[model samples]
Target: MRLSRSFLPTLKENPAEAQITSHRLMLRAGLIRQTAAGIYAWLPAGLRVLRNIADIVREEQDAVGAQELLMPTLQSAELWKRSGRYDAYGPEMLRIRDRHERDMLYGPTNEEMITDLFGQIIKSYKELPQVLYHIQWKFRDEVRPRFGVMRGREFYMKDAYSFDLDHDSSVDTYRRMMLAYLRTFQRLGVRAIPMRADTGPIGGELSHEFLILAPTGESGVFFDSALEEQDWLGEDVDIHDRGSLEKFFTGMTSFYAATDEMHDAEAWAKVPAERQREGRGIEVGHIFNFGRKYTESMDITVSGPDGAPLYPEMGSYGIGVSRLVAAIIEASHDEGGIIWPETVAPFRAVIINLKSGDSTCDALCEKLYAAAPEHFLYDDRAERAGAKFADADLMGHPWQLIVGPRGAKEGKVEIKNRRTGERTEATPEDALALVMKTQG
Candidate 1:
């Protein structure tokens, strides 16, 4: 993307309405714009980041054998009514009457709807176990929606539902999703700790929420650092193998991790003094094992091997796809701006032309960008070098290839590492090679 032609509207001052770092930075950096209270229109750069996150989520889910299928944003109210939750869901749910006076809702979650959909397809135990997922927009009418995408009324989410024939198998599915969540966060270049959580309206005894550490987080967290040190991406396990899953579950749960709501002093004291860690955490994902809750409520059942009707044990897993963009910023940003991870950055590196109109400088910037046009953002605008530098830092691409008349005359490109603030001079070819290698 060229700065001259791109829709990046960066700001010199923070927006007064943005109360959080991620919110303020997102608006000032031109990644998103507020279209309504608690709702936003993702600009080009923001949409690119969202897609990168969704892709990582999809890859991890697919690795665990979950098939993707999109469900609708508006769900029939009858689905909730059948489960006796229409009245219990409260004001957060946007209930409406369609043209025919039929009750409908902008879905906050898809438990009831997915249960009803799956029930319509499988009538027997032959279709016992299945994991289905979709990445879609969801809405909840929060009375006070704040913190930009972090607590937005409308946001993108990846929600998955698992169906199994028995309780033990359902628990295994839950474990599989736990691993998937770990791997997903790992690939996003963030460490998320899984802590036991209370399942709010979802209704499940077994639940866990993945929280990324950040000073601006909403929850106080206590845990051993060991939980964040695991290499989930390197783990080898068969999803269908019970023994392998049991070991994986035990390894993950062995660490003491909890939010303030679930903290235990006795357990905290058991850890070595040096190993104890305390911080604030923002929730990015959650998983629940609510066996038979939706299936029984919605009469979702299949014939058993013995020819008896049986309700399938179920679980639900969710990742805040859009919220993660903010959560990652919370966890990773510095005073300058958001230090994006290479894998999720809109562009891996940005080519800043310090002397835009100078013949040598322009030629060098063009040569550097042309080397990896798709992966580079060229600052082709005729702006002052100071403003270009400020915006480059504010946008936070991983690498900054700085070109100037002096260095360009000598065939040298100055490279700046965004994360480390390290600057070095090299030929255009060497600069491109370094950035591309680091991107990999």
Candidate 2:
């Protein structure tokens, strides 16, 4: 994408309303704009990042046997009423009335709706073990929606629902989701620790929140450092194998980790002081094993092996797709700007034309840009070198391929690593080769 042709609206000064690093940087970098108090219009650059994150999330979910489907943002209020939560869910629920005066709402979550859908279609135990997921926008009326997308009232979310006929099978689904979450976060270049958490309105006895540690996090967390060292994707556990999944689950839970609400002094004392780690963390994902909470309330049932009516045990897993954009920034930004993880960066590298009109610089920049037009952001704007460098750093492409008049004339260009701030001089072909190698 050419900077001159793009709609990026980067600002020189931070927005006063942005209190956190992610919020301030998001505004200054032109990733998003606030349309209303907690609602944002994701600009072109921001939308690219959001889609990248969602794609990774979708792939991980699909790998774990979860089938993707589209769910509507607006839902009939009758479903929540049947689940006995229409009234229980407080002001956060945006209650509305249609032309006929029928009640409706923008769904904050999809538990009751999904339960009803399953009850209608799944009548026998043969369809007992199914995982269904959707990536969609959700709305919650946060009294104080601040910190950009971190606590936004309107955001994109990926919510998955698992249905099983028995308690053991349901727990297995939960364990599988836990492993999936670990893999997803690892791929996103953040170390997210799974800590025991309150179920909140979800109403589950067993729940885990994947918290990415950041200084600006809202949750205070205590954990064992060993949790951060586990390579989930490297482990030889098959997602379809029950025993393998159980073993992996046990290994992960063996670590001492708890949110402030679930902290136990006795458990904390058991850990060696050197291995204990405490920090503020932002929640990126959550999974719940609520068993029959929704099924029982909504009378969702299927026939058991014995042909008896049974309420299917269920679990819900959620990853904040939009919030992750901000979370990733919070966890991995420096003074200059966001240092995006290559896996989710909008572009793998940015090509900066340091001397735009110079024949040599233009030729070199055009060559590099054409080599991988889709994977590179070509800064063809007629701007000063300083402004070009600042915008490239602020946008946080993983690499900066610099073409200056002198370097271009000498058939040499500079390749700078965004995260490490390391620069190396290379020919245009060598630089393209390096970027391709990183992509591979």
Candidate 3:
């Protein structure tokens, strides 16, 4: 995409309302704009990153045999009433009314609706093990929506539901999701520790919240320091292998990890002094093994092998997709701006025309754009070199290729890695080759 044609409203100064690094950088980079309190309109650049993150999430979900389907943002309140949570959900539920006075709501979560949908179609144990997921917008009426998208009242999320006929099989499904979640966050370049957490309004005895440690985070967490060194991406995970999945789950949970609500002083004291890590963390994803909570309430029953009616065991997994955008910034950015993981960067690399109108520099940039295999944001706008440099850094592409008269005359361009601040002069072909390899 050409900068001259992009809808990038780069800001000169930080927005006062944005107190967090992610919020400030997001505003300065023109990735998003506040449409209302806690609601945002994702601009072109931000949308690209959002789509990239969604794609990665979809791929990981698919890897675990979870089928994809989109659910509606608005749901009838009758479904929640059936699950007995309509009244229990409290003010966070954005209750609405249609013109005919029927109770409606912008969905905060989809447990009730999904249960109703599953109950109508599934009747036998043959379809017992199934996972269905959707990526969509959700709204919660947060009385105090703050911290930009981190704690937004409205956000995007990927929620998956798993149904199984027996407790043993349900545990298998939960383990698969736990492994998938670990891989998902690892690929996004965030170290998320799975901490036992309160089920809250979701209501489940077995729950885990995958948290990424950041000083500006809202949740206080305690864990073993070994989690920081353990590598989740070291091996390929086979989600269908029950034993392997179980082993991974057991291994990961063997460490001492819990949020403040679940913390035990006795357990904390048991850990060797050097292994303890207490810090603030952001909850990026959560998973729950609710067993038959919704299924029993909503009459989602399947026929057992013995021909008896039985409620299907169930689990729900959620990843706060929009909140991850903020979480990533909080964990990775430096003083300059965001340093995006290559997997989620809006663009792989940028082509900066240092001398915008200069014939040689312009020709070099245009040639690079025309020849490159991947999309490169060609900065052909009438902006100063310093401004272009700053914008490139704030935009957080993996690489920046700078073209100037001096470099063009010497048949070289300045190639920079955004994350490491590494710059080197290279021939045009060499620059493209480096980018191609890194992108691959």
Candidate 4:
């Protein structure tokens, strides 16, 4: 993608309304624009980043046997009424009325609707263990929505529902999701610690919130430093094996971690002072073992082996697909701008034409552009070198390939690491090879 041809509307000054780093940078970098109080229109650059994140999430979900199925944004209020949660859900639920005067709503979550769907078709235990997920927009109508997408009233989320015939199997499903969540976040270059959390309106004794520590985060968290050192990608996870999943669970849960809602002073005090780390955290993923909460309420029953009606045990896992962009920026950005992880960056490397319109520099950029992947954004616009450099830094691709008359004359291109700020000069072919190796 050529910058001159792209719709990247970067700003020179921070927007006053943006209170957080992610919010401010997202606006300044032209990734998103606020259409309303908490609703945003994802611009081209931002949409690319969102797609990258969503693809990673889908890959991880598929790897764990979860099937994708999108549910409607607008739902019949009758579904919530069936579960006796119509009034209980409070103002966060965006209630509405259709022309026929029927009660309707933009779904904040899909428990009631999914339970209704499961009850309608899944009658036998043959389909006992199934995981259904969707990546879709959700509306919560938050009273004081702020902090950009972090607490947006309208945002994208990846929500999955798991159904099992028995309690034992349901717990296994929960564990599988936990492992998958850890793997997903790890692959995105973020280390999220799973901490015991209050289930809130979701109603579950067993719940975990995957938190990424950041100063501007919403949740206060305390945990063992060991969590930072553990890597989920290092292990071979077998989701079908209950025993193996249990071991993985134990290994991860051995470290003490808790959100403020579930914090226990006595348990925290027992940890050695050196191992304790208390800080603010951003919640990126949440999983709950809600048992029969939804199934029982909605009468989603399956026939047992003994021919008795049984309410399927259930759980739900959620990842804030849109909020992750803010969380990532909060954790990774420096003074310049966002330092995007290669996995979620809109472009793997941005080729900045330092001396655009100059014959040698323009020719070198053309060569690099031809060799680069579709994801690479070539800045061939007629902008000053400093402006191009600043824009490249603000956009935060993992690598920056710069071309200039001097470097082109020497048959060399400069490749700079966005995260480490290390600059190296190499032949164009060598630069391409280095970028491919690093991006992969």
| Top-lDDT candidate index | 2
Predicted structure 3, TM vs. truth: 0.97
**lDDT (Cα) of model 2:** 0.93
Q: Write the residue-wise lDDT of candidate 4 on 1-440 in tens digits.
A: 89998888999999999999999999999999999999999999899889989999999999999999999999999999988899999999999999999999999999998888888888889877989999999999999999999999999999999999888999999999998898899888898999988889999789999999999988889998888877654557678889989888888898899988889999999999999999999999999998999888887799988889999999999999999999999999998999999889999899988887889988888898888658689998888889998999999999999998899999999999999999999999999998888663
Candidate 3 whole-model C-alpha lDDT, 0 to 1: 0.90
> How close is each model in CA RMSD to the real structure?
1.3, 1.0, 1.3, 1.1
The 0-to-1 C-alpha lDDT of every candidate, in the order given, reads 0.92, 0.93, 0.90, 0.91
Ten residues in a row with the worst lDDT in model 2? 228-237
Writing each residue's lDDT as its tens digit, candidate 3 over 172-221 gives 99988988898899888888999988888888788999999999988889
User: What is candidate 1's lDDT per residue for 340-435, written digit by digit as tens?
Assistant: 999999999999998878988988888888888888999999999999888889988999999988899999999999999999999888888899
Error of 4 at 231 (Å): 3.6
Which parts of model 2 have CA positions greater than 4 angstroms off? none
Which regions of candidate 3 fall more than 4 Å away from where they truly are?
Answer: 233-237
Task: Judge candidate 1 at residue 240 and give its lDDT.
Answer: 74
Q: How many residue pairs clash per model?
A: 0, 0, 0, 0
- For model 4, where is the 10-residue window of minimal lDDT? 229-238
TM-score of 4: 0.98
